[model samples]
Target: MTAHETTLCTLFAEVLGLPRVHPGQSFTGLGGDSIQAIQVVSRARLAGLVVTTREVLRSESVSALAAAARTDDRTRDRSGPVTPPRRFGPLAATPIMEWLGELDGPVDTYNQSLVVRTPAGFDAPAAERLVQALLDTHDVLRLRLPEGLAAPVPAARIPEPGTVSAAALVACVDARFATDEELPALMRGHMRAARALLSPREGTMLRAVLLDRGADRQGRLALVVHHLAVDGVSWRILQDDLRTCWAALASGAAPAPDPVHTPFAHWADLLRAEATSGRRMAEAARWDDVLRPAPAPLAGVRAPGPLDPETARNTHVLTLPPEFTGPLLTAAPGLVNGTVNDVLLTGLALAVLNWRRDGDGDGPPGTDPAGGRVLVDVEGHGREDVVDGLDLSRTVGWFTTVYPVRLDLGPTDPADARAAGPALGAALRRVKEDLRAVPDKGIGFGLLRHLNSHTGPGLARRGIPEIGFNYLGRFPMGDDRAWSAAPGHAFALDDADEGLPMAHAVEVNAAAHEGPDGLTLNATWTWAGNAYPGTRVRALAEEWFAMLRALARYTAKPGAAALTPSDVSLADISQADLDSFESQLGELL
Candidate 1:
């Protein structure tokens, strides 16, 4: 290996915390996965070097790779900031509450797509105009952080509105559209690239990739925003705005509707005020008590170790039909005063308990036999009740938080699954009330305290909630049938779609969808391979569904008749069976 290659190898090893690696070692060969690859690139950038996944994949030797990286001028950091290309309007700022909300943890959920066809009759000038108009219409598109927050000089300011040259825009697009395989890598690269370029010190981050398909109309623009800054709702807004802006440019008209919310800075100030208040202190104390430390890593599961390639082998998604969701929602108030989310959580908890009872052999033999599994972490929408009226939908901030909701399954009687509805409902109400309490609702403060010395080392060592649950708030994209201005533009996104990373533990998400009968619940669980066996996962899902169905029924017909596991067919209970149940339930609703 040449000196440069040796240096690169050493850096990679250090960043990845591997024992040793030679220059010729392939990234994949070194046990690198998407998450690890991101860390590799991030470390390289921090060390003042640039490296692309493609280069890492193709190089025969470390020397060749080092030479390629050296010649790849794009990877090299220019000493000075590039002049901010022209943006359309005043910069948008993140809100304080939203910023506090993000304190909980990093958002691994990401959605990305490659749009291949440019609008019909699209021209370079028109494209430029379209982008310019977009900037003019949304403050978020134009934001640039000024210097003074731990910086020696004022940061580069965004160029005057309408000043970005078509060449620069095209170059950005061309760089991104270089290849199909390159798109995914490019998407990950931009997040790191933008972070370096934007010098993001606080709040959630934003990144984009515009692949120029060349003059003939095959270009792709890949946009990825952190979940904290935007949600499915925000994406719908962005999609509509983009289509509108593109159509207007094609027809020679102006863009429509400027945004109407205060900048993120105003929100950030509000968060600071709220976080520092006496009320916040009390709330923090409550959270501290409620969120006990996560138990030791489950048996057979290693603690936050390097991402293993084996873990990525299986990808599966389990969706509930609309029929199930409809009835569940209708019966929610009576059973647990639960929203769909509460019902879902309760069901999941019961399912987990049953799975443990069934002795799936996925967990360690000594796991609490009574299923007193603790430290359940559920993803939460960090938007506190306090921000009820704020038009957060239009603002750019990370408004989601991940909070821990402990579940004591030991006391839950498996035989009394029907009667468990009220208890589960009460538990959910307490969670909602605690979560809504102003001072302690912010996940960020909780995280900050956990990281600080003042909170005691045990708090830091405990790790955030173990099992994560997130409901993407009912899949809002219309019917599954694809719709785009051009043919084949409609791509189906499913649970197996690439992008979002899974946790080392279990991650669950639920969405409502229309099925043959009615609205069904699509629940997905992406489990860490090393941590869970397939049978265990399957059993857990089945039990959860059965429990939920029972709860829904109990809630709807309180004091009428109680359902028992014996009443249900345990012998035939399966994931597919549960799905069918949900489908039928949807029709009832």
Candidate 2:
């Protein structure tokens, strides 16, 4: 390799934590993404090799980037010290917050937990210190529900990070002596912490437990935080930042993360302020038309009995190795001019339609034998490019956006399995096009429902999609620990589901990882069993896997047209029209 090529390769290896960057490997082929892409550009600038995000995106190899990279001095703004908060201080209810808050039961189901296998010989004090450091750094943990009397505090005052109690930073137990024997006790403590964070009565939104397993040579660190404080993207940034900060502190250095220019509080305030502006209102109006006479959101929920605490959302999982994941990543996104996310949702729509055909349940809640239409509430990470000046990529908090998507799968026949193909293909295409039509990836939904004074979350004003779906990118270990510096450094984050029924009929969250185990896709399906029988939900889960695999095959075929169903909407296409169309396209489809 030439000198410039070798230099770029070294930089890629260091930034991405890879052992080597072959001349043939692309940045993404080595597990790089947008954030990592930007990281390379930033580091490259500092390394005296100027590379733009565009160049990074297009480069086929290290040498390609090297050939185009050039050093150019440019001034950039750096985040300054913390500022005082003025407006946007309230625990302002966005659509997501309102949805969870209005669920008519204990909010403990919003609790999320993650378990980590600490570095060998990792001790309690060290773990506790790391917890404290995180508390001192991230302000999201300082928020609460303002339980009673508004605490008689001064106006416009936002709590700073690390103001909360250190002891409550985490709850720990030394299980080094009896790992197995202490399992039950450890669980109790974990659950206790989770319950504590679930309420503002504790004046905390996060809890941690450090399990000291010295003899066993594996120590476990568990973090339980309320959904109000973090999302999946926040988790990714938090874990990466925590690892870097923890290592620095261990070596006796002060912990510092990339400047959080916009504290979550400021972001929330700005969000509310912006919601009232013409932009948000106009966006909401456009969406209102798109979702009006809202496609009935389907959920296999029977009577959601008084929020039974013991009712846990069960999961039927499917794993896919690299053999499938690798190609799927390349083809799935291109098929619809969408990302892997589109593929997942498309597959989900197909599965839901199939479930309907199999007599799993009725459409939405009512409307007799409804024409084949499914409405689903979809979730996005909420870090869209909409915010021009602020970079929320590293900001921690609940930046989740929820919006309804109506899928028009013209005429699905359960009795005749042969007729399902055309329906599935057309449905997938419509879903892709519908999503493509959404403005700024659906951020307007929250702004209109909660921030907009005119609109309310009430059934008469704003409709609710009974089902929710999220694709949480990829898990760390899922990709063979490629992102980690060493093996056994992988960690897993999961919901410690309490078996409590969700207000919605069912919700699905999928995470991906690629390793020697291949590319494994773990899809967790949570449904209110009373509505859809457990057996039915399980069938849906299994069928989703089959449909997803089928999609991969369909997209991979030679000269397969990733064509749109039609400019004419499926709803416009009458039931009679669908029958006529399906019959004509039967064998060709």
Candidate 3:
């Protein structure tokens, strides 16, 4: 490798924590996933270099990446020390802290969307007004952070309504919404094209889109923000604020109250100040304990070959009935004094354990029925409890963390499934308490793990956890009347993709949907390609329903006897039997 290439390779090796990176080794071949890709991009960007993950994946050589990085104008200008933007306190949340904590790098994978729907009497002028209102509301939307600790300069004016690209408009919606097949391909296509228009120097980390389907009759306004700039909560805030702004514009009124809180830069400043004050290091050490690296690598079975490109993927959503959900909500106050999230997490853990055990033919190999341990990676909501009066319902920041919780299932009694609920609940409560005590609430710890390149084949294995749980808050649904007014809006919003896949790798998401009746638990799972087949997933869902029913019965009636696996003859229930059970349950509910 040339001297420059050698220098770059050394930096990569150090930053990535790889023992040694060969000049010709592919990043993906080295097992680089989305998380790692982000790390590489962030680090490279910080070092004044521009290199795409795809290039690194394809080149498979540090020397080539170095050459590309050097020639690329994006990385060459480290002219001066990067200065951070001004800190806005009340508005400043922890999401900005995490982004600033990222070792300067370009973002590789981007999860972007545009929520488009026709508003009543919405037109091009109104759309432009809404865009301007968005710019006026959130400081980050119009501020550009070039370096560290400096005032954020205003971003360029929003493009004209008609001039806005189609793809840009589509990106404002969530991935689940945008994945609909009926939507015009142009919507998706234009989004990708608009994303390409982003200047690496803009450090946008996110973008926006506006769509005017037609004059006054149909129009859609979307903000295609990058994952880096905000988190789920932040998006909700933006959506709510945008609606408020649009309403004002629709009525020929001025935008509502100005945001007075600290900006993200303030959080970044706090992180820096804390890092230097030794608080960050102490916090890091505390995380080291909570996130103690696993002794054994995660177990991952090698794929026989490439995943089937033609494999059909479909998502089915299950909502807990009132009878089942009501008690949990009532008991939530006493159980760990937790929110609905804790209850859902406990249920999910139990579901996973049951699913894993049920999947083993007779029993898991090489272990007694009771000795098998199941590891689950629970996705955290990542908001710091210390943030005074923080309105998670509105603030924006990618404040999510992932923590692995291990459950010893060896002694778990399949015969007494009702008994498992309390144990599962206890484990979740313990994890929650342990996490809350951490200085940074596991955010810094999570970032370090990702940055340090700790999870991989050699450093870590994958199969330790039979399942993953992510509880996203209430899904957003724009005003139906407003949505219908948009012309050419054909996409249907559903919770089909909310479940974990049937494969070995499963992620169960319990999304809350605000309905006339109250909160509905829209649960879905995404399974790994190999680990879960359709039959197995369907069975697990049925089993979960049965378990929930038993728990509800036991909880409601003190003298009721707990049901056993034998009592229900669950093993004998075929796919058809499960389907019938589900149908009956639906009818009864």
- TM-scores for all candidates: the values are 0.56, 0.75, 0.55
After superposing candidate 1, which stretches have Cα over 4 Å from the reference? 1-229, 243-252, 269-274, 293-311, 333-337, 360-373, 385-390, 408-410, 418-447, 450-458, 477-504, 514-517, 555-589
How well is each residue in 65-124 modelled by candidate 1, as lDDT tens digits? 688764324455779776433233323222322222223332232322223335423445
Stretch of 10 with least lDDT, candidate 3: 491-500
lDDT of 1 at 100: 27
* Backbone clashes counted, model 1: 29
TM-score of 2: 0.75
Ranking by TM-score: 2, 1, 3
Give, for candidate 2, the lowest lDDT window spanning 10 residues.
478-487
| Top TM-score hit | 2
Q: What C-alpha lDDT does candidate 3 achieve relative to the native structure? A: 0.45
Report the lDDT tens digits of candidate 3 across residue range 1-589: 7765665676566534456877776554443332334335544544556565445544546777777774335335677796544533222223333333332333332334445565635655555555555544454443333442122323212222233322333233322233224344645555555556443235344454444444343335545555545555565455546666767766778756335244444544453333334444445444433333333222112222222211237334578776565555434423333344444544444554565555353465322333434445666555443344222222344556665555433454443654544444334344334333444434554444433333212212222344556665544233345532122321212111122123225556665443435444567755555555766776666666565554444444432222222224466643335445656766798
| RMSD in order of candidates | 20.7, 6.8, 20.3
Best candidate, lDDT: 2
